[model samples]
Target: MKSIGSKWMVVLFVAVGVFMLFNGRAQAAYPEKPITLMVPFEAGGGVDGFARALASRMEKDLGVPVVVSNEKGSGGRRGSIALFKSAPDGYTIGFPHIATLIYDDTLGETKSPVDYSKYAVILRVDTATFFMYVDKKQPFKSVKDMKSAGQALKFASTGIGTPSWLIPSAVGSAAGFRTSFVSGHKNLAEAALAVARGDVVGGTGSYTHFRGVIDDVRPLVYMSDKKSYHLPDVPTIADLGFGKLSTLGVPWVIVGPPGTPEDKLEKLRGVLRKIIQQDEFKKWGLENGYEPDIMPPDVFWKKMGELKEVYLGLKPQMQEKK
Candidate 1:
């Protein structure tokens, strides 16, 4: 009886040991399969282009295929929610704008499908500066001229609540201009083409995204205080009059679903850091008109917190949409 009892205990111990080993091996062998990268915008847009490029490089570093899935709607909220709802395994991740991530809660837009706190921030990949462009045929050469005209100008944005919309709205409110906003485009390309054709007098969004259409439209001013590297000749809003109203470049962030293991998150972050630092990635980003402003997880989180405060302060002005 004593020998039988001892034998039973030995079997149980071996089973427990085997289970622990398997668990550790599973945890360490993260991203064993192809990873899905969700892009919350339509394909062929600037964000989509950037996501594809980053994914292509990341696959080389990670040794796994990174697939980009386009989930468009609700100003990028639909896909964001989907990404959040996905399993916390490292296989599922998302690339979303910083404004969409921070302002979703404050704007009462939609309950984030993913808990931001649970996800690991891989890195801040890029900052795209929005430009205020007017058709070259328009009489107003500069913002001062347009402001002095005092007539309401028609402006087109990607949508009502997007940064492309909000930045122009903020500028209009601060500069005390009667600006009318028209929505309906999926991204800046359509709106930019509309502005270039004189369907809309002005447009706003990343200058790089619109650089291809600059021949038809002339940039009036930058939305931010600092000048844009892509359009260095153009003056910034601060260079005009509305110093307090100037905004910064929108940051692009890569995040995994909540409950992703720390080690897995660190692995993603490590690959991203390496990719961002690579000369090929940097050159490609610059050539495509993106600034390589990579930030680590801790710093990126702090910036997200700060940007939330800034967006909240602008919420009141955002209500008075024309």
Candidate 2:
């Protein structure tokens, strides 16, 4: 019996050694294959542009191709579902519409839109400076004009629950006017077109979206306390005494599927940190109206919680467009 026990101990030690050896090699050989980044919007839009810009540099550093996959629908619901269902390997990462994530997780009465458990946040990239742009042809030039007009205005929106809708709706309510949308356009450009072609009076979106149609639409107010350097001419929501609504902006975040290895998550965070710190990346974001902010997972999740509460408080007013 003593001889048998000694033989079993030797076999166990050998097995442990083999396991460690293979595990080390596996981790060292990470990213041997290409990575797919899922963008929950159509190609050639602001979100897609941001993803491509980062993916270009990520591909060079990671020594593998980084492909961007566009999965457009339902204000980022379709793509989010696909992303969460994807294997938790580090190769798959994506951007979920933050508003949709918050609404689906807490506010919505229906079943959860996506698997909350499978969502693992990597880091936050930046927040957009949202603006309400009025068409050049409209008599309304600023928030005051829209309010004083004392008439219902039609605007374009991505969807009902999205920032594209909620912010504008809330602003209108605050301004003492009823606002409705020719809503359901997929991206900023599409909604901006409705403004340019004079389909609707104007719509709200980030500076990048309106950049493509700058001449057709006039920026009225930025949804923040401070004016963007890129759009120095535009006033802030705070300038109109609505500073509390300023925190509402489209936050761009990067996320991997659930169960991403700790090593890979750390590596990704480090690599991405380096990328955000680059002067060129910063310049690109500035020019495009993205305030490039990088935060670790802990800080990112904390901010997410705070934002949920903010929106939750506004939910009642928004639902009724009060």
Candidate 3:
């Protein structure tokens, strides 16, 4: 009887030891080593630059080195899908354009077949104002003039569902102007160049993105109610008598895969909030012509939900291509 009891006790001890091992592993703190931040766009673009700058600062705040990895393809669907499939232990996160993640899900652009709601919201970093620009040789000086031209003007975009496309579509609807779209470009630089060379009449993009090329083109009007910092002299769409049609604010968000622990998510948000408030980060954003609009995790999530609704309402129009 004593020998039988000893065998049973050994088995029980081993089971307890194994259970503790896994429990400890599960409870282990996030970012035990270097963390990877995935950028869905190609390197050297505005979004990629923002990710790199923010990641550099976040590394200091988190006390861990943050590495940026580019996974470009399929209108940013490839990187986002990979992010979703990654382990939710907070080691991997994605900096995805809000429109691509929220609107594309409804449009069937992403192949991962996962819903946007599955991701954990971290923080909203900044929102940029978009501008419409035409070549200097164009006869139109303002949006009204451009509309009166009474011809379908060709426009270029980075791709469908990007801000480069949505801003133009929104302005076209509001201004009663027809635009022809040429897509499948690898980056915004190519789209901007296409507009400059008159391959297209104009293109819509952030004022910051066209800083160097502003001299080659004429700024028609900003899509937002407020004038852009980069183009303070330019009139807004509201200034052009299109106040009701003016709606332009694209948020840069940080998100982790779904199923991440609440505590871990909160930790990441807390660190990001601290980093965003830093004077250096704010200065960098201001210099780059971006508005620093930071929000708490919960508020950010609520705002995303609201924007999702807005995008859903515009789905029909967005689906219609020129």
Clashes of each: 0, 0, 0
- For candidate 1, the 10 contiguous residues with the lowest summed lDDT are 108-117
Per-model CA lDDT versus the true structure: 0.78, 0.82, 0.76
Better of 2 and 3 by TM-score: 2
The TM-score values for the models, in the order shown, are 0.88, 0.91, 0.84
Residues 30-124 of candidate 2: C-alpha lDDT, one tens digit per residue: 88999999999999988898999999999888999999999999888788878888888899998878766776565554545566545788888
Q: Estimate, for each residue in 87-176, the C-alpha lDDT of model 1 and write its tens digit.
A: 888899987654765666666456555556555677778766788878888998877677776577888876766777777777777766
Off by over 4 Å in 1: 1-21, 107-119, 241-248
Where is the poorest 10-residue window by lDDT in model 2? 109-118
Candidate 3 whole-model C-alpha lDDT, 0 to 1:
0.76
Q: What is the lDDT of residue 31 in candidate 3?
A: 61
TM-score comparison, 1 vs 3, better candidate: 1
**Which structure among the candidates has the greatest TM-score?**
2
